[model samples]
Target chain A: MTMQNKLAWPKKITVCEVGPRDGLQNEKVLLTVEQKIELIERSVQAGAKIIEIGSFVHPKAVPQMADTDEVVKKMKRVDGVEYRALVMNLRGLERAEAVGIKKAKLTVSASPTHSLKNLNKTPEEAVRGFAECAKYAAAHGIELSGAISTAFGCCFEGRVPLEQVISVVKCFKEIGVSELSLSDTTGMANPQQVYEYSVKVREQFTDIDWVLHFHNTRGMGLSNVMAGMLAGIERYDSCFAGLGGCPFAPGASGNIATEDLVHMLSEMGIDTGYDLAEGIAIGRRVREFIGHDTDSSVLRAGRCSDIVIEQ
Target chain B: MTMQNKLAWPKKITVCEVGPRDGLQNEKVLLTVEQKIELIERSVQAGAKIIEIGSFVHPKAVPQMADTDEVVKKMKRVDGVEYRALVMNLRGLERAEAVGIKKAKLTVSASPTHSLKNLNKTPEEAVRGFAECAKYAAAHGIELSGAISTAFGCCFEGRVPLEQVISVVKCFKEIGVSELSLSDTTGMANPQQVYEYSVKVREQFTDIDWVLHFHNTRGMGLSNVMAGMLAGIERYDSCFAGLGGCPFAPGASGNIATEDLVHMLSEMGIDTGYDLAEGIAIGRRVREFIGHDTDSSVLRAGRCSDIVIEQ
Candidate 1:
């Protein structure tokens, strides 16, 4: 485990802002489609190259994301900016395609308990069911990637086995997805585990592009990001204002705060293509829009470079 | 910087909990001397080998720490457990000696502005003033360590120069202290800066033991800890319930939460010698005693290994 797994830190990284979708989906206040569009547009202005607008899911399950269609359709997409959306099945992909979402991602839980509780299917069933979604995406020329939730560990179950994660990755490979995200949906990931899993996966699937998603549920989100950076993974998923919560552990933090991540990356001399000052302002606006405080450090306390005018 | 950076992860680390002294001093409520003793005893019970009991500062300067002498005198000291107390001058050290405290720490700000504002002295003046305090400690057989506040950056002043920090370290060494702590008094430090500075100082002062102290002001506390660990630093300073507040950034977080650090370290297979459940319960009790929620991730949310029975 200590064979210099790597000390190579990425010079630059791509931050896929997931606040509009993954963040807002779990909030009590459902944002209007206009607000969602503004979120996407402002994120682009804040120098985010990729953003998850929203998810094409069943309205009953996630009422907050019911306007994903309108959000994708009404938003102004910049050329070279990747606008992604989450899809669960062929129906969801069909909806995303209908709204002209160029990138559609599918999520399956790495833990059987999570998969059954959230998707009403076991991990195997969920992975097998994604074949049709993959075929539809390939036929329609849509960029589809797979996300394995509970990749590190689960609250319902204890630790998710690395072999199980590998099997899920194999299934995603068989379905023809070139990019994948290993998500710490409940923030059960640590640095050693992240480095080990990241290295092991990169070794086994050299062809796949990896994206890391972590929750700050236990304050290890950015630490895990450091581990991933050391493991040579460059892409990460973050939420503006940290606007999500754990469904299993409610009131717990959700995703890594985007502004905080940008702040750290910029301070680390790792280019994140983000205007940290602008991003912090957007996070504040998000808090004002939601009419409640989100679990973001940058939103509560301004960026490190901020000039303290009065203190 | 691209050097392998020793990717050498330490097998175990020592967490010197500063919640009682550094944390409570910044708090509004003055915890009873009994409460302080209980906090120390319970921390040792939770497997903490070292703890900062309180400070021996003037009562008017810090009302919350006014009872520190009583706390030190009344507390039952466990053998083999290192108990530390913060002091500002010879008088404070004499008071600690009167209370039978064996270890005493003296702090000076690396930033000149902070030194003037807090201590009414320049950095050099403050460092020079420590000579008498060090002499008294040497005469009294007390283990004296130096703490440099705002070692990374200052709220009044921006980034402190690396040369200024090194000069302060040299001053501490000149004063006869063998251990020094570089504290990000306000959470303005990043992982890269931490790694570079830590490596630089360790290389320069091969005879000194270094402790990295961080606040979670911008959410980079744990990430900075990771960087320090990567830099081969095995000592850190953390608070119990993240109880401290930034005196400059009033509404911001103060120190890295102890249980959160323990949770992350334990998950990384880095032995911290903490019983996670006991530490968390103590954190909750501290919150209840303080009558407000602290800026702790693990306190708000259970540890990652905790199983959700009804979720």
Candidate 2:
């Protein structure tokens, strides 16, 4: 596609598949560390460059992801692919750092209530926790990516003021954090909110790369993604088949489905170096593995061109 | 809520729920007429004014919607609700008319191969058939709404020429179609195509209402809906729980899920006069009634705010 073609439309955007970590954590079936590694390998083969391998949360709290270290250790490190792991606190950061994990994400809830319930800390404490985690990552030569959960809105608190998100971003940036992700932890984000929030973040911090983490809990995941894309933010986190929801976060759903996101981007003629059908197929396999139907519509319904006209 | 709030954004964006018609027809387990009627009643209650309740297709061909007459007969007629039935030809139109359907939608495929396989007629023959259906509807004091399926692009034919869609729109207008719906029958539409196509149709038929029928096959359904909405086309079709697809249309899924569409519109503070939570609940009820899950993500995961956070 030429520049005019690119400008005449939204480019086919690259997708970051977060299914292995974000998707599996919410499942009732606890896949073995081998299964998690296999899932990551399949996702990479399916053309996922950035994959969330696992979270370094307490095994006691999230038994499903108990083998995060083993899974990450055994992961086949592709030449160009980036491996990501989620860390919630200083201890999790230490666990990731100990595993030689080079890149990890730190999440803090914007809503004080969610922070308390989910992390056993307040928003301020969570920010402090990130500050600590970022410091630890820096000392250990790991890249720290901070995500403000409930940046768009919160389930417990209802509406999280944009000021709170800005403050969180400001605090994170003050500690030399250059990569940030805005999360709709409860999926309360509308397109306008996404646009306004994204624009606000971009205006405040021009140097940082901001990724959007949206949930389809209320069915606005793709719309929010579009709004974020239109607002000039590119990186987004999606799960295959729109699966995975936090068992702790009430009403939280799987992130936007990777296949659905890729489908949209591919249709826009943006090159993601990914296969749409393969993405859907992998999503279905994951769905079968989990033994539950996923929320992704595209996985079951193939692309428009897949229509078979019977005579 | 208020006129100021409603007009604060775009006003009167038409959302036609095609769940009863488009959504149910694609399911393996066919719903009874009573269940279909109940779904339609809830749809109208949820502020769907234009409901595509059923189609007049052959029973053997689409056994899922075999009881179109019974469904149409039992549907509660609201004062402003414009109920529509899909008609593929003169025979379908006669059946729709016999059932007292005041508004009948006639479809002609833009892709020749699809038209031949789907309707066993050439494009010219399908157009002529719609023209005759229009005349018949007019004589019977019913309105004819003409739709061109695969207008954006076809699965078999690949890229559908822009002129082909425009020509069909012109023919429908010339035949005095008060309304026209351009369908991405196989989900071959992207935001750019949606934008370009709607602009083209608007320029050609300034007097006719252009309704868009999109499938979320590639996950661009809502984006295309927004693009069309921005292009000044208000009326569009959706399915409850995003249910519906042409069994013959191969990879096509249901139209935009009604709850998700309404959720997007309502959250923008646009007045859809619909309750998002209620729509999802209705979708759930229908899922149980049909004994299968619908493709709507919102139904499985309620709104983020709807989550009950136990203290």
Candidate 3:
């Protein structure tokens, strides 16, 4: 059978680097502000147009991100690159706006069990909190992108209902949040689920910007990306060195490696606007800085175009 | 915006275990004959219908597979599971038949440069050798499967043209070989290439069985499998513990992990008739036997359905 008409892939995609925020928060080592700044700057040099620099949560809660404020203060803002921070509450939003962060991402868990455990709030309470933060950020001239965590499935509540996720997205929309992200917090999504759910969500939220955040847990990260792309998603979140796992999800691996994702996308004739080699180098450096091996495959296996030169 | 019609995935697939041959050939450690027998037995227990037990080559060339004859001799034959060995020439076929091996795989390189470096023959010469082996195997009541190495791309010759690969397939068909496999020897294949090439090959060889062997060299192994499935191909080759890399390609990684493939397939609702947990256990054992970490993500992340119980 002729399959020329079956495959429909996007020609271009926007990859957001989330290594400095999500990656570092789950890391054991506490990078200094300078190191965090270096990572963000290097990510920009690697052609990342958007970087999630840090999260504005309580320092005592996540000590690894204690210097997030300082890191943002010292970071070199490159032209045309949007540096965003994650804000959980109104206080976090205030701190981000004070630091001159123009774009802030507000997240709430879709599953009540995960929300209670991670945020000490029910799903309703978390959504209410996000509503307050969204109002504050919008009034303060900050662009807000809302994220629904555990959108695919939750560790505490296995197989989170798609109805629950749709409700959360509806709440985000009700609160005037136009950009939204669905996070596979436990990496429990398969390609079919991703494709089916994304198709439904996109149909429901016709005007919102849809972003996908997938974990490499169970090894379906890039496959989920492909499914999302086929479902018409254009923005994705990845990390350098495949760093970061959900602290609440046991045995979770990192986010998809930025270099690995870029390598596949670039080879498939999709434009990612990132240098795969440069991303690999930064991933290696981050691995060294944290004194741990990363989950990146591209770092271990060079690019497909790499010529094997014999000595 | 509704994409429910574009994606076409197969409902069932056949996975062949090749860790015993392709996986072990590039390993530093050599398994005892008993250990090799146990692995093959475990693969059968894990629902592998076909297992490549060993390769009949010169012992000096690949010492890791030196005990091929002993392994086939001592292995317990399981009903419904077909055990096969790799035979490169008429002599190798004779050795396999002498040991009462019922099925054998004959391989030739599609690229002349790789054929010279790997088999010390031109592409035509290797095909001629495979033709001879096919004749002998057919007459001796042994089922033969022909594989084209470097069928996607080659390290020495760069991109092996699709015309070159098609020519090799034509030669295999002319030799009366109906079971054929195309190997991405260097792991240079992308999803688009796999989809397009597989569609073309399936169109030309409507009655032949086609198998895809991919390496995770650029981390596209499982994605390529997805592409192949979308293109209507049903058979794939995977290795336990994601073991094996090309000895000729400097930066090649292992074949797609059997457990990883099974995990994705099972989660996607595709039946491979394999127990994913059992396959993971075998992969873990193989990792211990080799005293090295594997490239399997499911081995690290567990299955998507695994419930993370909070401490």
Interface root-mean-square deviation (Å) of every model = 5.2, 7.0, 3.3
Candidate 3 residues lying further than 4 Å off, grouped into runs, are: A246-252, B248-252
Write one digit per residue (lDDT tens) for candidate 2, span A71-142: 877778888787889987788888888887888987788887877887798777767756767777888898
Best-performing candidate as measured by DockQ: 3
lDDT string, candidate 3, A1-311, tens digits: 35583477888999999999999998888888888888899999989998999999898988887777888888889888888899778888888988889899988899988788877987767776677777787788888888888888887777787888988888788888898899997888888888888988999889999999998887788888989988989999999999887564455578998999999998888998898889888999999899987777778777767754432
Clashing pairs in 3: none
Error of 2 at B82 (Å): 1.9
Task: Name the docking class for model 1.
Answer: medium
What TM value does model 3 have?
A: 0.95
Error of 1 at B209 (Å): 1.0
* lDDT score of residue A37 within candidate 2: 77
- Which residue ranges in model 1 land beyond 4 Å of their true spot? A1-7, A117-120, A307-311, B1-7, B308-311
DockQ leaderboard ranking: 3, 1, 2
Q: DockQ for all models, in order?
A: 0.51, 0.36, 0.52
- Estimate TM-scores for all models: 0.96, 0.86, 0.95
lDDT of each: 0.87, 0.77, 0.85
